[model samples]
Target: MSERIKKELALYKLREIEIDDMKLKVEELKIGEQLGAMNYEEKVQSSMNCKNNDYVMNEIETLEKRIRFNEIANKRIDNALKRLDIDEAEIVRRVFIEKKSITLTAQELFKSRKSIKKSIDRAFEKLKLA
Candidate 1:
């Protein structure tokens, strides 16, 4: 595979991880918001709740930015895949987009490991040119 395609695949994988992390953060923030609301009765002594809410809000904003970035990256990947041949696109989708292991993808596609690898390499080459 060409270095450019490798870099793009690596970036797509990293963005997938980032998206998952951002989703988790968003969920945590939502839970925190719920908890903070529940503690509204205790607003007398622990003014710390207000501070915590501010922190949670800041985290939510950061998470939103990450989600938007991930969305854009996903669209780019989709466009790239669309430009590829069907078989090449399937290989790329299985390996990168679906996050499948090579062996697993091979099994699922009823292809030999070597064949799957070759397809992946060809996909990368196509993506590099694209």
Candidate 2:
């Protein structure tokens, strides 16, 4: 690839990694919340000891901020995809926008499951560049 193209690709990949990391962080937060709830139920006071309570509150705040930022980045990617004029945009729309599964989206888009997945990945890369 040309230097410019390579740079764009790198940017796209970085954005994708950011999105994926944010999603993982959200999952971690949910797991933390569940565990916290369980712990609190067993012993509310123990779970909220001064230091632990501060730590947990800080963690939740950070997670919420990360989730919000990720959501904004997701919207930016979506807008970028819309501008790319990619024919598979509808497939993306159904899968990401409508939040459908790969199998169902493949059926809707008349593509094989693997193709659908590749399309999604490429779409992410395509939109990652500013």
**Steric clash pairs (candidate 1):** none
CA lDDT scores, all candidates in order: 0.80, 0.63
Q: Ten residues in a row with the worst lDDT in model 1? A: 38-47
Top-scoring candidate (lDDT): 1
Cα error, candidate 2, residue 127 (Å)? 11
Assess the local accuracy of residue 45 in candidate 1 as a C-alpha lDDT between 0 and 100.
Answer: 46
TM-score for all models, in order of appearance: 0.65, 0.39
Candidate 1 regions exceeding 4 Å error are 11-14, 38-47, 95-122
Q: Which candidate number has the best TM-score?
A: 1
lDDT by residue for model 2 (34-88), tens: 6665454554555445456567667767866866776676666566667654656
